[model samples]
Target chain A: MGGDFGPGITVPASLDCLRNNPDLKLILVGDSTILNQHLGENLSVFKDRLTVHHASQQVEMHESPSKALKNKKDSSMRVAINLVHEGLADACVSAGNTGALMATARFVLKMIPGIDRPGIISALPSVFGHTHVLDLGANVDCTAEHLYQFAVMGNELVKAVENIESPRVGLLNIGEEDVKGNEQVKTAAKLLENSSLNYIGYVEGNSLNAGNIKVDLIVCDGFVGNVALKSIEGAAKMISTLLKEDFSKNIFTKLAGLIAYPVLRSFKDRIDPRLYNGASFLGLKGLVIKSHGGADALAFKTAIEIAEIEVKQDVIRRISEQVEKSLTLSKSA
Target chain B: MGGDFGPGITVPASLDCLRNNPDLKLILVGDSTILNQHLGENLSVFKDRLTVHHASQQVEMHESPSKALKNKKDSSMRVAINLVHEGLADACVSAGNTGALMATARFVLKMIPGIDRPGIISALPSVFGHTHVLDLGANVDCTAEHLYQFAVMGNELVKAVENIESPRVGLLNIGEEDVKGNEQVKTAAKLLENSSLNYIGYVEGNSLNAGNIKVDLIVCDGFVGNVALKSIEGAAKMISTLLKEDFSKNIFTKLAGLIAYPVLRSFKDRIDPRLYNGASFLGLKGLVIKSHGGADALAFKTAIEIAEIEVKQDVIRRISEQVEKSLTLSKSA
Candidate 1:
């Protein structure tokens, strides 16, 4: 239900998911022909277990979020969200247009009880293990309240999925000081301080990559988070270009690379987004995970693994319980 | 002058600058003793060519920008800024705290006559040649006027240093549409449209690393720019780690690395940021380049090269002229 390209990537990903988990079933919410072309000749094998619901229209990559959702009634993403809304699917996944998907979910799925604007939380590979960076590209200009909510949601998601108790949450600021960043962070810090979450105060950019912060969740505005995500992708490309260049420089370093191959693979897996590809759109009624568009079979297989973990964890149920508890406690206090 | 590590990193970098450029002369601003310890042999060779001034205090990295500037009276960073302010030095370079350095320059060196808050500009090695990302962690939040000013400064700097006749300037946004992004981007778009600069309208994150945009400068708030920059760094590290693993897997790839060393070095040089280490703080009266604290000799050398180019091109002069021209035209219109 994400975008035009969702069916192409998702079909292959869904096949991998089915192969890994024998009991798993897939309900494809896309044009049948395109989905079939990508699913290969094993179409009949997946019959009974797989269902393809016809969806003709698609939200464009650059289409305005609201207009796309409002105008395109039977769009795959919208229909997918509706499926979740109607209690048809356990979770919905999309890799198409982020804005359109988020918009459709908000307009159709509606915000969960106390949740404001739902945030896109992705696990970034850091030196100190996995760090969850929220608001990947949902709301560009986030308020203090939005950031506070992001912290709570991020903490809950990590706790439920990763099975961590009292995850440390850090507000992404320019520097470490409580008053270091702009008005938003300064105000957000106050909310975080007052909230029930384990707020670790302000964290800087460099520390985001370092293993020192000891925090599980890092909350930031979508603009910053999105830029950070893209920057990492660009940087990875640059490094690959450099590595290839270095290997081709002469004979010695190429030989060194040979000796360093095993160590290199270990390092790659440590930071591979494929190992950390599944991004959960928290605060929704049902669990939703967005995998990278360019994810190969292995990466897609890993995404399914992540989805299984989230679904089994009853993430949405836990979130609802937490929200209810908070509301009750607030009224009592 | 910027941070405590500035001297440790800068002295060697300055020495490299002198070593590389025989015509270059250095005026070291800090404690004469420590400066001499690092530059003793080089100092004797340069003799009267190199001069060191005594400064007792140093600015800590974690200090708040305002407090650091206000309280650290005898700090070397303050002294360095004062040198530029009083016309003692043509430009300043630091690898210390960026916020404090910007604060010191704005308060001490002052804005370039008509310029507003000073912006930080770093030329990232993008797939589309070198992409200039401006306001990189300088002003976290800015008005429309600030962005317009950034465009002006970015254009002038790019033209003077990069030699791009009319470098493309794109307003960084969530989408490429004229109506996308927050209120700040919308307001800035209007200002950019009326400006004398070559504004390429809006650019999204995907277009940032790609050459498809045909833009030289990508302008955004310090928060976005900084996150983007750091994310790229993190991503590059991740990819390099992965590539190393792949190459080390077996003997064939190891042998290939040995055979392809020259080509590898060429490619490495193309993407290595150490080849372009310094981040210029634009819109200031004098030049201020902030290099990485962990910058090695190669990185320092690159920073020195940047400083030389910036100084020789008279970037400050071009920026001042552009700012003045833009302001005058706006007022008249």
Candidate 2:
């Protein structure tokens, strides 16, 4: 019903996730007839933990967010969120039309108090560990208030996910100077400074992948964040393509590639995008994870695992509590 | 005088460039006493073609652009740009403070008629060939009008430098849909539609490295452009670091790396960033190229070679003519 592979990937991923996660239960929202076809043989094994909810429609990948919101009320993505909104599910995850999923989720779940808009929070593989970046496509044109909120929420997320005592947050900009950046970024920096968060100043894109020592969270407007994320993906693809072309040039090179297989594979595992799958829609009242639409079974299973972690960590409550505290603090000040 | 390596890197690079390009002549603008130290041994061979002009000051890397522009009238960067502005040299190249160089160049040479601010245009290594991206930290907060101007100027740049007949120009955006970007990008699309360039609608950042079938010139505001470029560099660095770690894991891995050395070396040559050094400040009245500050002799020499190609193609004159034609077309229509 969602994603490029639809039930072909999700059904198997959900079953795999349930087996690995002892306390997890999944409610799959899609066309029941098609879902039944895929669940033909394995239905009895996961009958107790997995339930299928019938959703009449599906969100098309290319559909406009507004259009989908208006017409596709019964889409698998929307129905999945509805389950979370009704407290029937602990969290919701989708690998569907990103715009449609975000719009539908926002309309149903709403935003946490003192938060203006939800940010798309995701992690990228840095030099050593991982670096979480936010506002990935949620608030395209962000205000100072929105960026500060992202930082606060992102700080909490990193602490919970990475087990850091105090996560340092950095504002993304063109230069590291105090006077650099557009008006919005400059104003946001000032806001972060005045707040109680462990706010590091500006961080350039070149140093973003330097890893955990530099920063835990990097915040920016969704426009800049989206561009940075996609650029990272593009560069990785370019390098791998070059490496493959080189390792297969001739018979001698093929033999060398055979010898180097183990080491090359270890390198590949470190840089694999699947190692970091699933991006959270932060600031939402309900926890929701967005997997890549083209993800395979392993990647989608990773996305499900991410949702389980956030639900256990109570990410939504953590963000809500912090936002209310900051709002009151600002009022008193 | 401007670069991190000072005259040490620049002098050697300029000499190498002169030897390679038969028609190329150089005007070294820095302290004569220091410049002569590096040029002492090879002074007689290119004495007729290479000239030295003494300047009192050099702009530091982290100096404020406005402050440098206001106080440093006799700086080396300024003197070299003056030569181009006065038609003494066909083009000027600098490995100096980017902000100061942009401000000084704009103040002295001015923008071409019908263009607003100048854009920083440079090439990035892609799958099959190179991709030229523009506004790489020149004008951070751009309007719809500014983005359109960048597209017009960048279109001319790719045509002149790459010698393509009608290059496909794509407006950089977070998504490929018409309604995917901010208000400014949406408005710019309309302007591009009515213009005289081969506009290819919107392009996402992920598909940028997909080679020539899609786009030749990718245009965006300076803020997004700079972030995208730097993110690309960071990803490339991360992949290489991972590879090195894996290749040195054990003696077996070491042997494999040695056997695969030739293939890996060939691959590295194809994707080296040095091949795409030196960014052109497009839409200016005179040609000016900015090389990387930390560039070595080979990288800096490539920057000089970039300048030679643009000068021979008369990039400035081509842009001036296009601006005039487009200005009239808009008025008449």
Candidate 3:
């Protein structure tokens, strides 16, 4: 029971994914009764590929991280993560309270060696393919050292998932200028410059979305990253809303909207928010994908896709090896 | 001499503004030779409304703030700000180096009493109306006190410029939850709660563009504000580009795009980045509008319109008085 629809949306999406990918198997962990109601007649069809593991407790969105961790011993989110921890599943995906999910996942899987805290990492649909941005509200008050580590993990993640030999890492800042930013960003820039990564110096937010992607991976503190992510979401929504409003203003425009519906729909599909749903909890020992709490069936399916790709690429092993290498290099240099 | 295009764009933009607004008088500050070349024979036609105030030096974009202040005594940016300082112009507008402009403007006009650093405030076209956001790349690493001050300045700006009494103020954070942001944002939330302003508490980045318009003024430190601003710009561009690409995929879609071109054009015009060109430097003794460095004539014209409105409203005086009153109320409480 996670996200707004809880098991209602998750169950159907998982069933769909399992049907599409022949080798995929899913363990649906939630209130078995509620999930069964949604899966009603379809349970028999997917019985061979799916297992229903019941968890009585659920984490509320308002619950504090520590509170949820202490009280909810049998939450679906926790049990799901436990499956990954015990090596029963390759990865787990959840559409639950972010703080609760992060706290529980960190507690169960633990951090990769040399990783202090697992960061929230997600890919944004940029003009040129996708840009991976890390620490999306995982650690709001990040230090220079934390930012540098995020760059290392994010670099390795893109290399593993996308098969990019050396992904360009960018330190996100207010401006492109070397002198323009808070003390933490400036210090992080210095660290990134000396590190054995393809550091692209400083990148502003516009560069993140522009089709001619300047940097493959953008790194910043959770606060900045989260704000930037949400801002892009808001802008895209507002623009589309404005277009619909304009098209509805008159009969002529309405006719035009009708004639152009196919093109508009195709355009909408390209920039659909659902396509970029899951955010990985990088630096964790096991793969954990956090779907948006308000995600629907389609968005949840996209989140599951992230898990499928990550598991296929062995993202955890790659991130682990890179972290160890970077740590050793830092100590020596 | 000033921005990227120098007098080529600025001179024509000023001329257009002068033609539109009869009461407007413009003093073009830059190299006289370049200004005359751009102005050509049009100088005689606009002679009554325009004057050329030449400055020999120009501040490059990469110049350090301190270096620009000390070395560029006769810089166009400095000279333009001096006109406002000497009561020759009600406000000064420039598209020059931001750091140099801020340093020169602050040194020339000084800050209002109880106001620390002046914030770069601008209007973003939101769903409901335009929302005012401030400290956009002014003070990157700000304290809670500084954030509170930005709220006061931004609140006053919305009131004075937009004529909205008791405009709702929001503290921008990673999440709307009171516990979600860094320590600085948390402390600032408490301060805003206690202040006399109509503080609506924390707002996330999506809320900024979402037409619901929770608050009229969104306040944050410069770093977060800048990133949010750029992210919106990037997303808008990306969405439009994707829409065009979708339309060009096939013959039927191309015809649909042709039929819907007018409605699409109007929609694009509504959210055109040129319309939101000027950013006000608030909490200073005098008004100063910072135009985009790469702004074209149309965009620079919009920036000049901002200066005209602020000057007409006596924004500086109103901001100073309200800031004093707010500070006094806080001290007593």
Candidate 4:
């Protein structure tokens, strides 16, 4: 009902997650007939831990966010988020239209106190495991204040989820120099510097994956963050395609590929995007993870696992407290 | 006098270019002593084709654009661009500070009559050979008009240099929809739509390398473009590092790597960033190619070769003519 494959992919992913975690209970929100059809006889086995909350409406992938928000009140996405808002569900996960999901989530759950906007924060593969980047197309045109708030939230999210005492926060820019970037970034840097958070100076786009500078969290306006993230994905895809094409050029190279299959498989596993599929909607009152719309069953399960961790870590409370502390410090100063 | 290795890299690269392109002549602009030292006995062999133009000062990599403009008049970057202005050199190539090089070039050669600002355009490897992208860290904040100008310049450059009759031009955005992106991008899209150029509509970041839409030229503001370009570079580097790490994990994997060495080498060659080293400073009255700061002799020669092609094709005159035509069309409309 939400993603490209709807219940076909989501149902299997939910069942897999439940099987992995015995204590995890899941409520499938979608058209009951389709959900039940996908669930099949398995519903009888996990009937105690699983249930279906029927949602009549569905949001199209191309639907406008505002249109979806106004019209699709009973959409599976909306119903799932509503469940979270009503405290009936710990979190919600969607692989539907990003704009629609974001608009609905913000409208229903609202923002955490002291946070002006909600941002999408996701982990990207890096040399040092991964780096969490925020505001990935949530708010395209961000004020310096919004960027500073993003840093605060990103810093806190890493601390809670990654178990770091103090995560190194970096403001993304075109250059590492203090003088680089537009007015918004320069002003944001000043705000971050004065805050109690572990604020490193400016980091260039390469810092997102290169691990040249080990920054745990990188913050930028949604537009920049989204573009950078997609560009990285594009590059990775191109490399993978080129590798396959080169390997299949002739019989000799095909033999080489066969011999190197094991090594290549391990390499692919280490850099697989599915391992980092879930993107959290940060600064919201409740947790919501956005899986890639085209994600497979395994990837969706990873997203669900992320949601589980975030809920257990109480990310919402931690971010709220961090924001409140920073606001008070600024007011007194 | 510029970049990390200075004449140590530039001199050899210049000789290499001259050697490959028999008709091409090169001027080594830097401190006379160091330039001559780097040239050594090779200067005599190519004495007729290559010469050294003495510059008293060097622009520091971290120097401010404005400061470099006002203070480093005798810097190697400035002198090289000055040669272009005085009709001694057809184009200038530098591995120097980007900001300084742009500022000096803009000040010395001025802008094309109908253009307001200069943009840095570079080719990126894609599934479809390469895609030319513009405003790669030139103007941080661009108006809709500036973005339109970038499209015009990028379109013209591709046509003249790549010999594409009507290169598919795409506006880089967060999404492909008409409703996606900020006000600036939306307005720019409208302008591109109305223009006579081959505008293909809005393309997301993945289009930069994924080749899903088969765009020939992509345009954006400097900030977004720079971040995307560097992010792609970082992702490529990360993949290379991970591949090496996985292959060298143990003796068995190393054996697999040895067996697959030829295929891997070919794959690496296909995606090498050095092959796409040169970046053009478009919208300026004169041509200036900025090579990567850490480029080796071979990579730097690629930049010089790019300069040769642009000069032969008379890219500056073509862009200026195209801009004038567009301005007239808009005025009448």
> Per-model i-RMS in Å?
4.2, 1.5, 1.2, 0.8
Which clashing pairs does model 4 show?
none
Superposed by TM-score, candidate 2 places the C-alpha of residue A265 at a distance from the truth, in angstroms, of 1.8
Error of model 1, residue B41, in angstroms: 5.5
Model 2 residue runs over 4 Å out of place are A211-213, B328-333
TM-score to native of every candidate shown = 0.88, 0.98, 0.97, 0.98
Candidate with best lDDT: 4
The better-scoring model by TM-score among 1 and 3 is 3
Q: Give each model's whole-structure lDDT.
A: 0.76, 0.87, 0.88, 0.91
TM-score of chain B of each: 0.93, 0.97, 0.96, 0.98
| Tens-digit lDDT track of model 2 for B49-94 | 8988899998888888899898999999888889988989888889
Candidate 4: fraction of native contacts reproduced: 0.86
User: Of 2 and 4, which scores higher on TM-score?
Assistant: 4
Query: How do the residues B1-333 of candidate 1 rate in per-residue lDDT, one tens digit apiece?
Result: 444455567787778778778888778888778888888788888876688987898788777788988888888888888887898777887777777888888888778766778888888777667888888888888988888888888898999888988888998887676756889989999998877788888886644565355679999988888767766665555455455555566787666555554554566667776876889998888888887777776787687688778989998887888878877567577
RMSD of 3: 1.5
* Candidate 2 chain A, run of 10 with poorest lDDT: A206-215
lDDT tens digits, residue span B189-282, model 4? 9999998899999888889999577999999999999999999989998999989999999999999999999999999988888999999999
Between prediction 1 and prediction 3, the one with superior DockQ is 3
Better of 3 and 4 by TM-score: 4
